[model samples]
Target: MLNSIGIPGLIIILVIILIIFGPSKLPKLGRSIGESLKNFKDSTKDVIIDEEDEKKEQKQ
Candidate 1:
């Protein structure tokens, strides 16, 4: 869905968000989002490793 937005569409969306959130809030929002994404990525990696370990044990 987002892939269809293209560069111009992204620029427009960013501008709208900037207008709504203002500059001061943008940094905080970005930092929070970054942290959330990082945590999600780490959790997913842990889940994948656990699944692989289970499979290995089952094959033994």
Candidate 2:
């Protein structure tokens, strides 16, 4: 679904976000989003490692 948005669509979305949040808040919002994504990725990686360990244990 997101693939179809293209560059123009992204620009429009960013413009709307900027209008709503303003330039000063944009950096803060971006930082929060980045942190959220990082946490999500770390959690997923941990889950994957746990699953792999369980699979290895089952194979023994």
Candidate 3:
């Protein structure tokens, strides 16, 4: 899917995003997205740890 967007298409998309979002809000928006992704990663990590603990308890 991503490969379908060549350099020109990518540039156009970025330009549109910049216009819609604006420069000032872009950093804040990027940070917000980064945080949400981090939260998702952390939650998945916790779930994996819980599963490991459960398996260990079962083995014991």
Candidate 4:
């Protein structure tokens, strides 16, 4: 989905977000988004690991 956006589209979106959020709040917003993504990634990794372990146990 995002593959179609390209750099210009991304820049436009960022500009819109900046206008809406303002420079003062941008850092906080970015930090929040980063933490959310990190948590999501960690959970995804845990799920994959659990699935792999389950598959190994089933084979054994």
Task: List TM-scores for all candidates, in order.
Answer: 0.93, 0.95, 0.81, 0.89
All predictions: root-mean-square deviation over Cα?
0.8, 0.6, 1.6, 1.0
* Per-model CA lDDT versus the true structure: 0.98, 0.99, 0.97, 0.99
Model 4, 1-60: lDDT tens per residue?
A: 999999999999999999999999999999999999999999999999999999999999
Q: Which prediction has more favorable TM-score, 1 or 3?
A: 1
Q: Name model 2 segments beyond 4 Å from true.
A: none
Candidate 1 structure, TM-score to reference? 0.93
Candidate 1 colliding pairs: none
- Model 1 segments beyond 4 Å from truth? none
Give the per-residue lDDT digits (tens) of candidate 3, residues 1-60: 999989999999989999999999999999999999999999999999999999999999
Candidate 1 lDDT by residue in tens digits, 1-60 = 988999999999999999999999999999999999999999999999999999999999
Clashes of 3: 0
TM-score of 3: 0.81
Local error of candidate 2 at residue 1 (angstroms): 1.1
| Candidate 1 clash figure, as a count | 0
Query: Candidate 3 or 4, higher TM-score?
Result: 4
lDDT value, residue 52 of candidate 1: 100
